[model samples]
Target: MDVTQFFKAPSGPASMKRKMAAEPSDAALKRLRNDEDNDNDEFNGDEDDDRFMHGDGLTEAHRNLLDIVDSAEEAPATIDLPTLKRYVLKLEKSITRNEEMRVRYPDDPLKFIDSEADLDEDLHNLMGVSAAPELYPNLVSLGTVSSLMALLEHPNADIAIATIQVLSELTDEDVVAEASEEGEEGMKALVADLMGHQILDVLVQSFSRLDEFKDGTDDKQGVFNILSVVENLISVDPTIAEKVVSSTTLLTWLLSRIGMKQFDSNRQYASELLAILLQTSRENRLKLANLGGITSLLKAISIYRKRDPKEADEVEMMENFFDALCLALAEPEVKTTFLEEEGVELMIIVLRERKLSRMRALKVLTHSMTGEGGAACSNRFIDALGLKTLFPIFMHKGLKAYKKAYKSHSDSEEDEHVLSILASLFKTSTPENRLRLCIKFSENEFEKVERLLELHEQYQARVHAADMQFERDRIAREEAGGYDGDEEVDAADMRYLNRLDKGLFTLQLVDLVAGYLCTQASEDLVREHMAFLLNRKGKDFDLFIKVLEEYAENTGDATSETNSERALILTVVEKLQIISSS
Candidate 1:
């Protein structure tokens, strides 16, 4: 997409192109003349104009077929399959008629699919034999799943492959959803049957292009479309994962696909699908682990770890893959071995996406840390400064303070959910690691440090209690001759000791100095933080004075109280000093 061009706001008024693009779907021209296809092939149009949709152009056949499909849909699943088939046959002729549409309206089909109604259509049903079984019962029959599977090899490879790819979407989702809803083992078996027969070579062939081919855009696009079908199919029918493990050849092929560079367009989506496939491998998960699949996924994340980091497609793809991997790793089953595999720094990355990815990362981390995975995690956490690395993430909200955080809370029913998770982790987790997590998240980054301290205190009691339990267990275990190694710490049990020792001192100072960094942020972030810090009636003058002295030294160009911020600091300093001196 022309990202900038599409995102650009209306000029003094709307432009002709903008007006045409935004016209109501009912009014928009779904069909356009195709100049490219000598046979006047009409491509399906998707209304994906960026304002509403991603705005990739579709063609005539896709458009007309969709219109026919839409015109046929009832409230939900009530499509008249027999009539629909007849309509589709006619729709094919319409596409043949509009073969010339591609020339004049190369992008019209993309626009049509972007329309709300068209976009909302159940895509799986569109391609599945069940949706139109009366017309092609044999192709879509329960027994015919294998028959449909055969199309994957028909002489016209494109038609056959596309049909099978679409079939993957159709049956699997219904079967899987059915299984989940009613505990139907039969549904699972049915899904296994259809997918088990998959043409393994075709699946790999779909990904083999890898964007290296020099000619034939049509063929290349067909491959891309097939890949898209694969994405939808795997997403809906993850249970079909059994098929992945059936053949040693298929398993190795997918593993190799997962190991491929994420930057390869043809392979990128497939790599992500492979991750999903791994997660769905109910009994085969252990096999996946032994094959280094988790490491392969981490390597996928590494591919996205940019050095200079311009915000681009790679960044976006990396973000998507990052979330998928974390989500996969976080699942109860997957988390078992994932945490033990040198993933602490990777966990920190999840907890620190610097955007919404942070929450997603945290969700997965919390899941892993709360289950059996937590045992392995706690043992490994302190070795890597585990929770310490994520502490800053809990404390961040740009240069702005809890004002933004609070604003967010007001709008979202979701709390600053991380606090509770950390508290829970602190209570259930080993005391040493809990304390380190406290010291870590408690740093003062951009705005205020007090929030960090407050979160620290909220968890302190639970952490202390947990630490006590951990200490007693340690002592008893030790007396029993259970000492694991010299690496273990002596309890030096001071039950009263805060353990606000040397390492945490840096953490506390980071919390305090992080307030100053807020001023360095863009003014909006600074103003937001100021609004939060200045909300209370009380003050801390000595701390404010110290902050002012440091700000003056760091800024060199400071004119002091003439700046509103400095004046506010001086005001806070006077009040705090009085409160302190008293």
Candidate 2:
């Protein structure tokens, strides 16, 4: 039996089939081949005759058939809207009918397989809705969504798989954003309905049934299909993604699935989904961390840490693992988990020994150390004795060489991140750790401080040029009558302030190191480095004064750092003045 003939609305005259089977006229052949519009006069058939209408002629039994046939001729033919609504009704009815058949033939399981397969094919045909997602409004109103989601938990796995296939078709990624409507109402309405009906729970339930240990063909396809549907939903709306992570066992399952060591697409997809979920929510990250996710992630990537994966997807999977670990480490609670799992040791091993995951490890470490809530992580670094390894990498000529090779400031972002990490580490340091940091940099004739000064000069020049350019541009805009308002000026000013402040943070870090050496180190060490610190170009003195003044204005005399740092700055000022006088 022809499958296309199985499901369609009735069309055309009954006698017309015989006429169509007969040898068509030369005119009919020409029209059928190219759909060319030839004048009616070219054919000798009378206009008033019923047959001349070519099956569209008005008849007592079916006058509307002609209009329906005309509409069906449009390209990429779909069942008409009314017929589609009726088709949805049939799909809803088939679900109940299939359940009844399963009950009736309880002993003969194969009896319902063919019916389930046919129903699957019917659902697959619904892909035509992509071109006309507007049709989704009516289908959703008819409770087709509820019926389809119910099948995801059917006793027969085949029925569940078929439902997944249909859901994937409805929410395909490529068509979600391209739905042509006023504000994409079609796709938005479809997703809203899916989410509102808790499709996440249904989809996750389907995913939970698949066993990766079984190499069965159906099981593998089902896993792939379910992942695709979940990806599509999350890609369309982030709220759905949050719901997916919070509402299901998916995060825990993905944590296990990625460590399967199979090197298959399923493992690769699991890695990707885990990264997306962790990045989507801090709660998701914390949840995964609580489930021993950080350990699982480290174990999976440990294989490829020493060398690259052979396949592109495997490499991507590993990178996703890296990304996920980075996001998880941002949470303070997860940082505790990291300590328990010996995560610092793992990252240090990657940095010190592994070439394949070296850059990625640096990024994870940087994210772990830098930022507002990383004081505890910074303390962990000290307790782990990470400085023994970190200082060598920072002072290596290779880092400076890499910084010099890039011309664009943006290209040096990783280098800046490294600097930020160091600054953050020092920001939360105790007196003992600060002295230890000073001793580490003073090795090899103070090369680290010299490098820090060089980097500070470079960023200072960039910041100065940026500030000058902004002023010039602001003047130009005002001269051309292009000053929009205070909002635009204020926004631009805020951006400039951020750039200036970032530049100053690095410079201030250098000042901090110099201040520590002056206050905490022996007098001989401060004297030895005094000229190098005071004599650089790029307004180092002005920046030092600016930082000092900001601290004074923002903090009171009661602040411990303010009082201590003020005394250190004054002492450094006297040394610089004495050097200038000499």
Candidate 3:
């Protein structure tokens, strides 16, 4: 029967017709949604009162009818086929109003589906049809789904497209749930079936529509409907993604849709859906090595990334797009394709200088190293000093990102690069494996430190010279009988003294000074910096405390003083439970 015929028919499932004499009538639906019901605390409400009142929503007449039906219910009510079909139509039409209607008829949908005897066997047969390939050789089920997919090919294009959209949105949850319930073996079967059949047909037909599609309106509804269908089908059945991507022919169609020259709404959605398809199947990773896919996609993203840097959604889209594209390094074939097409230089350029693209590159690199071939290729690139250029960025706080965070205080917390690099490092455990990762970053950093030390000594002598001048001036001023107020010390000298003498404020300068001693081991630089920054500036007693008690506890000093610093350090270590008991 035509779909319209089935809708108008008087016979359907067994449970739908089985309303008892005491069942609540349609008016009860209005009672279910009324404000009084919501306030009554049991969570029942008038579904009609929903904020978005639509023409297709539950009308007062339908609620009264449901109230009449509910009032008639009694135990073991026998609903006839005729009455069941009527209720089925009512339920189907009321679906658009579902967010509200489900609340009103809470027991009906569950009871209607749960009982095997109550449901139409044909409707239930739609469950995971793709799981058994022999079952739906035509790519559409015989009853419910067949009727739905057929709607896409209907002559009334608007009606067909709308039907496809509604059907996809409406049935997607149930289809996915059914596939999930079957588990992996069933899922693989379902994916393979869709990959071989329905997926190709949809792409071909959708692409064909582009020729006739108009800019203003002829294309919109159909394009959106097509994408919605595409999204629904692949979202739950990712196995088809590889099939769509690996076919060089399908790849060309996708490229033509949203690559550099095309940026319309349909193309935009196509790009978005393409991402979803690859992401779900992880086929996107493969596409990075696919001829024309990566280069074209990145070219598109470079433009978008630059054009809408401030638009958070665009940034997120760019992120997902590249991340999936970068998964190319996984297969040796794909890796070769990548360097051959774009080369190792592209990876470094993206990492070193491309604004947001660097993050996407890191993400892809992380995935690439996840696979054996990718790990080896990435090692070669790094041995060439790619990582050396990037590692310095992680050492300095708040220096990694040039873009401001849309979220608060996240900028102060930690570097994204540090987290990214650490994640990449954790993949391997052996030192022979990890040593190449060190990038000799500390060597150059240490050389810079030695240079800084010479400057530090020069600075110390200048400060001491100023102190001597102050002493000379003080004696001369007093000798003159009355010291002129103009005997004020230079601003620079006073600033230096304040920094040297202050407490917590001096810690900032101490950290700068102690950082020069970074070549020491076991996080010794951080330890020394923390302690040295804490030491009192220019006080001989405090200096003795630092040298004898904290700095060189292994060496006994020639000058004798009480070792309060050592006691304090030991106390702190004990409280923290860092050292073990004998």
Candidate 4:
């Protein structure tokens, strides 16, 4: 039997499926019968006599089947300590034999191919150890982790790929979830050992060696599996994200891979891993910025600026890139890099073009233009004629048209992001740019203020419904032998969280933008228009003050920046109160 056939790698998204041992083939059965006949000719010749003496019982084949079943029944259901140690030893031996064979026959595939096959089978068999992650420390102590990492540099790409598959399985999140507290400690130890062996460097180096396009499906699966391994490690130990970026070229490889125009599982996986890494580690974000990650990501996503992705995976890849960009923009320096790379301009074009990327571009813009770091991005956005593109969406006319044209458009999400961008503009713009923003609301017959009021009412109604539900639930809980002190505090916390989820957060943003315009609009025309609209709804500046005060209180005192922003909101509240009294 050809052992290599059993080791064929699976294609598409990286997943772990253990390869079951194959049944014996007809040819192997014939050979086994011939050997038995030659070794025991007396028994073969006396087959009839033997059957009669055995009381018409089993033939040799039946007896063999019975023996197999008996052994299977006696086999342990799960791999235990002794079995794991033996498996590790077998894996190490396979690795050593394959290495030796390759060294002895550097130019001869026939000489080393069997060893390579054996090694592949061994690697896959090791995946069974993942089911028993509580034994990971045992597996590590057996010293096969280092051996597996070494195989990443094996001469044959298939061997390296198989090794990655094994590693991915061992470090998978499912294993993490299944592990007990002791098993978790074992997993941590195993991860530390893998890292100590420079798994990140080895994995990145394997990327250069395995050419997915040139080497066919197995090589492609290899790249995907390598990504899975790294992602799994990070999931197990979030600090690994920083370690990966700082210690290896994995981040650089991810940036390059995602930039490739060819859309494939690996590219999609690369985008996802990049987003995960960026979201997890501030140091990784800075590393990405210094490596021109912002520009690379923009260029990668710019393809969808005009044309939407044709496949669901391609669309997911686009969203991942946008998510990574937004996370990266959270870093102050990355925002600068984004502006320098014409990111603001790209987003404006995406918004105007009204492609599938429009909503994500809006979200990216909101991130780029937020906080003190966003001052430059916000100013640049206005300079790039962003207002012309944004105000149309903010007004909902363009958004309505977009939703009609595209089935997937999200009105509330788009509205939330657009309002967030406006709020950021109000917060971060300079005196000159601030006036430019306030002027937009004043123009168009106070149309922007009208829209703000419309959104305020919409979100306020949603929040009000949620608040009513909260009250009912609280009263019910109180009537049914209510919570003790801790439970009461938890219930209160849940109430606020429930409110936030049911549009309270968006409502706060709407009120914030409205309050900013009321106090700081370039002309009194915008403020009066807002006041008129508020009175029309039986609301006034006092209502705005009340919401803004609640919003400010929730801003917390965790950071000085939070305190400062809280103070700024309170100041806006004070100004609104004064105007309301007058």
Candidate 5:
């Protein structure tokens, strides 16, 4: 498969010639035509012009069959199994007959043009299968998919586009997902069958033949259908998804297609496919990252950093770029390359200068600083002067600033994410980096630590309110016969399972920072704000303590000696204990 098929456009006459050459052999066409003749003698005329030929000079039998299929395409109606299969066979026969006619009448443009119209109608009939997916298995067994796929390489662009539409309808994600929910074999089986027949290679061949920039309607719709088919396939199975993203031509095409300045449905879909592929597997993510996918993605997103996409479709395209980038950064290889390419600088610029993309940049940055890549990203983040840029936003005061900026309350997910990144920095900090971060906070008279404590208190209050609400709701439910005999226990289990619902991770993050400050800055500096970390909802303090104890216990098994992060957490636990005692 030429991975770069998307880079080139389909040729006009030359492409048609190739399809003409690839048509079924003379014997197969003769057999199919004979079968059609036997089945539809009434439509077979006597004279050369009268016999199976239209005003456009198409075969009389072929023209009549097309009329039947055309009416069936009027609405989302299902043709019975026997009739649908026969129609499929008839369509294949028509395509085969057309190929034979093209070969026999190489000089007869009228013959080939009418044949192409018949092929288009037959493809439309097959697309009606989208409304009746239960018949998909029968269609597959009848070898309809393989035949349609072959038409993708058809000489006529309209015929190929029509074939693409049929395939897209057959493998649409929603159609397949709905089928899967009902335990029916849908896209999964269809894609597996397609993969068996080397559908990807055919797609790439068709892709290289068409140019998006200069293509006519048929060619453009062809591009859309090809991407749609691939998207549907990938969304169905992991193995097939891997096979696709792992393709060098496909990866390159997707990257190039999305970078085009003209935003359209196909470009938007290409962006979406890239994102889904990356999100599906680490291998896909790594594959694209290695292919300079990140650079392509950032360039696309950077276009919208300062300026908002005016059209809704353009906005969706920009969103796909952001989503794809976030998933891409999850790969360690991509993260290292991202840092190497000054991606952090771009994100900083977005946050600092671009209002529309500010929080999106924050999200990308947060995802970048997580998992195995977190330490590397954190180190690079500091080196890129990320701290100088991030801390100011983190320390911004007042509701107006909050609403205008991140629009997150003091302990909203956005704020929690900012704290999460801080925790990651401290968790992965070298002593040198640790001291630098501490000095950053101290430079502003430790206002950063004070704010962390203030945020912790705010979250603690919310946790308290949540606990009260849960208790009240629980009591009300118990008195109102809301519980089944086993329901009370089930409710308790749910509460236990969601122990972190009270923003425990964010609270721990605050303590993680406070613990770091205590080790580097004056203990009194942390002590002044230590009370801010105390639980506001009476016995809820025990829950906070339990979270810290669990962290210490988990760390004790992972390491023989206490790391600074663990030690700092223990220090925070000790301080909280002191506050509880007092």
Candidate 6:
């Protein structure tokens, strides 16, 4: 006869099992009554017998047990509107009692400890609301949302942590997915209410007070729960990512946290959150740049520049930092900041070191030296003697053996990034640096040009195979009457997309690099080496011109910049055509 069982809410199967376990069997109760009767006979007194008997020929204790069992049987099996209201009422009372006790006896833990424990239990019990997220609006209407939010600033860290756990559970993605359309609307209203209550500001401020090392597990879990809450909120409303960085100290806290020397779960989580925020909006990216985020990320990731991460989690953290840096570098202003912080030099060192960071560093360089904003980075890259490192990778030298010794890496992926670096230099470099680039192809007996042609053939074969497949699919579809009479334009568009997907894009890049070297490099040597390679493959300059023509035709809108790039590529195509005619 557990009194706790009388108060327990009718949760699902688990609660049923607990209720059955707590109840006494009928035989056990009968035996107990018989034992009580024997004891009564031993006492042999009317007063004792009268105290045990009731008017219905049963003991008063046995009748009370029957009443408890009846009430338990009559309890609602699932949470509905009335049950939710009761839970809310219970929670509100617990919160009020806890706050009152804390206020009345601020200096005495003993006086308020029981109330604090009760409040904590109530907060956790509220997590059952997540199962009925469609009722979130009702929870909000009951005014407990504010009470729960206020607990984020509670004087007790445990209370704040418990509140975070509840919020995290409520906003969880699985819960959101379980919701219907009406439930989604309810979730929206709930989140809107939380935002109106300054949720982001409160969450950011909590970071300073919640020390993860203070109580070890509890505090660590508190910090993790806080991150989960933020992640859940963002998942519910992606636009909150911009609001998070724009309106609060979260970005700043994240930057400082990840910059800490010691590696921990919170630090890793902070890095991941930072990456998510930066990837959300251009405004977020620009904000990071203004805050010296580039410098901070560089310092944090520099630890692994020469060495690999010790564990998989650290590897993930390092990748997050790199991801954040690359996203930040998308902004022109951040690219400038990246260059000013000697980011190009660091990347070059990373490339030369050939650590796990090498491939990612190459990706960062490709981003840094892309588009019109990358001119300065391109110049700084050459000025830093980055070519000495770029060429060997371009030629695929020593990479296979290194890949075997350390980690398996994609040779094609390495080739793509290296070729991208070269393409960027061709597009963004000054005349002097452009000559320096062309000389790299010439200095190694046209070795770079030869490698370029080999890649061209390789990707050309891939594109050819894909084109054949597309043709076969098209023929089958035509035979089967799969095409509408008016879908010729649509069919042509799909073919182009299929080609791009199956190496046409990389093939265009290869041809673009070859075109650059053919026209920009020394006329006799590079053209001859390229022509000799093409001819040896039983191809000619016409192949390069065809790829270039196709590339320029699809080179996007005819904006002045696009027109200029298209004009340059067309000029290269014309040159190749003339060279072929000769």
Candidate 2 residue spans exceeding 4 A from truth? 1-87, 93-114, 133-135, 172-176, 179-189, 212-218, 235-242, 280-282, 370-373, 396-411, 461-481, 490-539, 544-582
Maximum-lDDT candidate: 4
Q: RMSD in angstroms, candidate 1?
A: 20.7
**Order of quality (TM-score):** 4, 6, 5, 2, 3, 1
Error of 2 at 416 (Å): 2.1
Residue-level lDDT of model 4, residues 466-561, one tens digit each, is: 999989988998899988999989988898899888888888899999888888745688888878877887878988888889998889784566
1-582, model 3: which lDDT tens digit per residue? 122221211222211211113455455555666735554564334544563355544446555665556544422243333333443343333333433443565555542222212222222222223233232323222223434444445433433444434444333434456544433333444345544556456545654643424533333545554565556556655554665566535556656666645334455566666666555444555654555676776666556433344554455556656654654444566666555555455556665663555555656655555444555545545655665655554444234355453232222122333333333442332344345443242355444233323333443454456667757766776787744454355544564464343321222222223332231234444333333433433321232223223322432342536554334333333322321121
Instruction: Show how many residue pairs clash in every candidate, following the order shown.
Output: 44, 0, 35, 0, 13, 0
Encode model 6's per-residue lDDT on 1-582: one tens digit a residue.
211222223232210111122255687578668867876676746755675684454556667667657745744566578888887898889988988987898877778778877887677767767777889999888888799888888877777877887888788878788889987887888888899898988888888886676632355666777787788899889999999888998888888899899887778888999999987599999888888899999998788877788888888889999999998888898898898899999999999888988989999999998865888999899999999999998888897688896666877777778888888898889999898888888885777777888898898998999889989998998898778756878989999998887778888889888888787645577778778877887988888888999999888665666477788778889877777887
Q: Which candidate is the best by TM-score?
A: 4
Each prediction's whole-model lDDT (CA): 0.44, 0.65, 0.44, 0.83, 0.69, 0.81
lDDT of 2: 0.65
| lDDT score of residue 168 within candidate 2 | 74
Q: Give all candidate RMSDs, comma-separated.
A: 20.7, 10.9, 21.0, 7.1, 10.9, 9.2
Residue 202 accuracy (lDDT) in model 5? 80
* 3 or 6, greater by lDDT: 6
What's the TM for model 6? 0.82
